[model samples]
Target: MSKLLKFSAETGEKFLTYSLVSVGLGTVIAQVAPHVWFLDNYAGLFQLYKKGFAVEVPSHFETMLSEISDDLAIPVKNPLTRLLTVIGFDTMHFGTTSTTSGCFIGIPVNFNYKSEKDIDKLSIQVGNKSVPWDSKDGIELANSLILSDAAKRFGIAYELSLVDTFKFYLHCFSGPVIVIICGGVNNYFCNIFGLPYRPFPVKGVFYGLLIAFGIGFYYLSKDLITTYYEMQALKNVSKVGEEYITGGLEFYDKLLARNKALRNLLPDGSSEFNTDGDSIYLFRKKHVPITVKKQLLEKELEKLNHSNII
Candidate 1:
């Protein structure tokens, strides 16, 4: 009822919706009328932010990013480390000695050539430790996060909308075709303000307001859309993080189990590391990096605990 209708964090308030409507209306007018400057501005804006976000980085990124990177093994030399170097994350390489890696769009991720051996060669450094990856999950998680970040940075899903390509088809190509054929026929019948009835400098005041509004829309949209997606992405990452942790623990279990079987059967003094010592694999790479979603992991673990307790 009122709660649903109320302007709140959940809804990005009414202003965002209103701004979207206004912006959408303005864009439509720019297309139909195809007023040169208006259309040009719309097209330019779309081209600029076509990838669902503007090019700016977020401010509070370090805090949340730290939460993500905490104990998340990165290569001693990794692109991710390079990307976050300004914020005190300075590492090198996302791959092994023969492995090649690079960053794209500011995301510290390795290039995926779709080769298993190449990917498996990738390892990240956590403190003095090296954690290796075998699966594509880390890269996948990075892609979602990168896109979400772009959206958050730019303030719209224009990057997600893939609308710039559509604009090329609908406006850049078709708009001209329609304008040309219509112009030719109109010349014979009517003279609409000599040629090309420009709207700017006439309705510039109104058009200027819409452009101004669009700027605000960009900011708010980033705030709203990013707020929502960040939550969901974090939830997914948390689940993956849990799996990554569990796998590591299980890998340790395997080593312990094997050693236990060997130790008990070996009678008096027939062991390599030590007769009574706990077998700890120091050099062996156990699990890949785990990127956690802070709050989501708590909630997830809570649910599991509740079920077990019941």
Candidate 2:
């Protein structure tokens, strides 16, 4: 095999160079390709057109998206923001979009049910004990999962606002940016200290540290971008109207309650989620907590109420 192609401690520089390029290309493909190839081309594969849900849910979402499309400057009719009902996903949110066409949104199939009986099939079953939909807590849980029409539109609007900005492209490019910066730094230091010719142990430790640093940098950037853009989306959603402002408050409240219910119902609830219903993150959190989200909307409502009283 060629010297660069051979896998050995002697060819550390070649390995490092290949690793950096591989990671950079991998990140770009993972982030951008799914939207372009899968979502835009064959979104119908993931779309749920169940007997009862086919007409109502998608039609409502399309109408809601169109109503706010002008205000948000997102196109409604052409290159449509497609809708799909995802089974495993328990909430509604924005999915990835194609750079060439438009974006898509995912709604949890469970979110389509309005009453307790309607969602019984999806109830949590731990061993033999099933979470009943008729009990007082069960009724509350059911109610929490189903949002008012106004709250539903607000949720859709929030997801729409998320894609309305240039943040997705920025997020996609972050992976390559980190790869370039880390690779450049490593190469600079290697040249200064004489790298590939250095002892095996020294080179190993140096490469390992650089890899760790790159991973840490990736996660930190990901968290910061998520936090900032989510807050910005909420701010944009608040501009729609008074009903949507009220809807935002209700949406978060219902989300928190649903998580609280899940915590009580599921077998591993306590470990999986906190008291406030946010996931118990091992390292960094990727989204705003439900409690904090609700509080922000509540503050907006308070301001609206005070202004009206005057």
Candidate 3:
């Protein structure tokens, strides 16, 4: 019997360790693989390029001002363009560039609209470097800035719109996706050679299938091995608690029974019985009186209350 008990204990420990190892390995693989392959390096590069392009509008503005001033003697140098350029350069150095910069920079500058009737009244402050220009004539100024006659003829708003769209895709989405795909493929290949891992041609499909199977097993009648053990431990503790409660109740019930028996033995009209706090066993005679019968009942009640019966 002792040998059987020892063998069972050893087997249980080994099984528990194996289960822990499997769960630990699976969790580490799932969490680390995705971030290392697709999320970190690829996402990081996309963010860097976006930051580099965040001050693209300000740069474009500077170029337009330089070109327009050269042709029309307007002296349109924008201080805002210099500040934005410095900010963009600093962000690129820090490696903290992302899509958020575009929103922050673009939204502030484009907040107000240019009214058609008040085009002459609209003036943009470039910086201390250049004079503010009437925004009503911004299209013509933009056109003058362009080197290509065809491009200049099309108007500044058209050119700016096209440039803005191109920058958005290059900085925000396309650049990031391309970088992510390249890094993911490279990492996947590296993992095959470096780790105890094999290459899967249809990894996405297989991963989906594995996840579905795991979920089904967790939800369906199949064993929830870890949860089952936890429940079993709780059940054991509940059983111990119930035993203690039952034992306490049984003791209380026996005490009540003994008290009732003592009350029955007491004389109905006796002075001892009439008073609440009086001990019926205290009135002792050399010969057992009818009151002595009550004393014996009291003694039995005390014994039952003190003894472990249940």
Candidate 4:
């Protein structure tokens, strides 16, 4: 039994330690490692991008989206590319050398894109360093940031419309989903939500949110596991508790019987004991009362089989 308890304690401690360490590591990585953040939350970013590009707009993004859509809506490149890409951005090169900078909300952005293997591995480079066109990790990271940033600016540049509102919702959603695609969620949402228009670093928000989420999840799960174990342990000891209660009742009944037998011998069958506080005292004819405390009775019963009470 001692060995079993030792093992259970060790296991519980280890589980708690592991959970804490994992959450702490995840938070540290999310904060210091931008690439990891991007990879973890890319799914949410993709969803936001889809919402951003679909809204009707008159900005440069709209023009780009339109041309890209036309080329993609009916794929002339391949039967597979019909609904997605007009020309694969993988091979497409853009530079600020009079060929790549595009106007975004009147802001000229150095948007350049390249892909390797296929569209799934497309990379976008802004200025001299975005991500290499061939680096899959770099490309994925860029794709998340670029698409999110572009869509947000496009929403801002265009008139008040469904797109802007959607962008706000996207920002709210993005605040917590920082683990995926390092950066980019809802720039529009962030601006409006923060109001008064202060500059909010998206990456900083991402890291903080990631850390908060990791810690929250770890503690929540640990508490749940601990509760479950406590319940199970109680269930295992239920029989012992029951035995203790039964033993106590039997001891009381025997004591009462013994007292009654003693009194019956007195001809009048009178009681000879009285309860006083936590003690029981016996009355002796022409002598001082002898006393036995309730605790002593319980202790005597307990000594008979210590395990049951335990």
**Which candidate achieves the best TM-score against the true structure?**
2
| Residue pair clashes in candidate 2 | none
- Ranked by lDDT, the better of candidates 1 and 3 is 1
Q: Per-residue lDDT of 1-310 in model 3, one digit per residue for the tens? A: 3686556545644663465445545544543343233433332432322334642344555465355334332222221111122221111111111222221111122211133343222332222223234333334332222232222211221222222222222222332333344345434643575311223345445445544644443333222332233233222222323232233233223323323333333344243332322234342321222233334334444555566464
Best by lDDT: 2
Model 4 weakest lDDT span, ten residues long: 90-99
lDDT for every model? 0.33, 0.72, 0.32, 0.32
TM-score of each: 0.25, 0.85, 0.17, 0.18
Compute the lDDT for candidate 3.
Answer: 0.32
User: Which segments of candidate 1 are over 4 A away from where they belong?
Assistant: 1-84, 88-202, 241-297
Worst 10 residues of 3 by lDDT: 88-97
Which 10 consecutive positions of candidate 2 have the poorest summed lDDT?
Answer: 89-98
For candidate 2, give the lDDT.
Answer: 0.72
Question: Where does candidate 3 clash, by residue pair?
Answer: 77-130, 79-126, 79-127
Candidate 3 to truth, TM: 0.17
Question: Which stretches of model 2 miss by more than 4 angstroms?
Answer: 1-10, 40-46, 49-58, 92-98, 122-129, 134-137
lDDT string for model 4 (1-310, tens) is 3686556545644664465455445555643243222422331222212323522223445455444334223221221111111121111111111111211111112122222232332232233334344455343333432323333322222211111122222322332343232212223334456411323365356446745665454444444443343333222222233343233333333334434333433333353433321113242122111122224334544654686457
Ranking by lDDT: 2, 1, 4, 3
TM-score ranking from best candidate downward = 2, 1, 4, 3
Q: How far is candidate 2 from the true structure (C-alpha RMSD, Å)?
A: 3.7
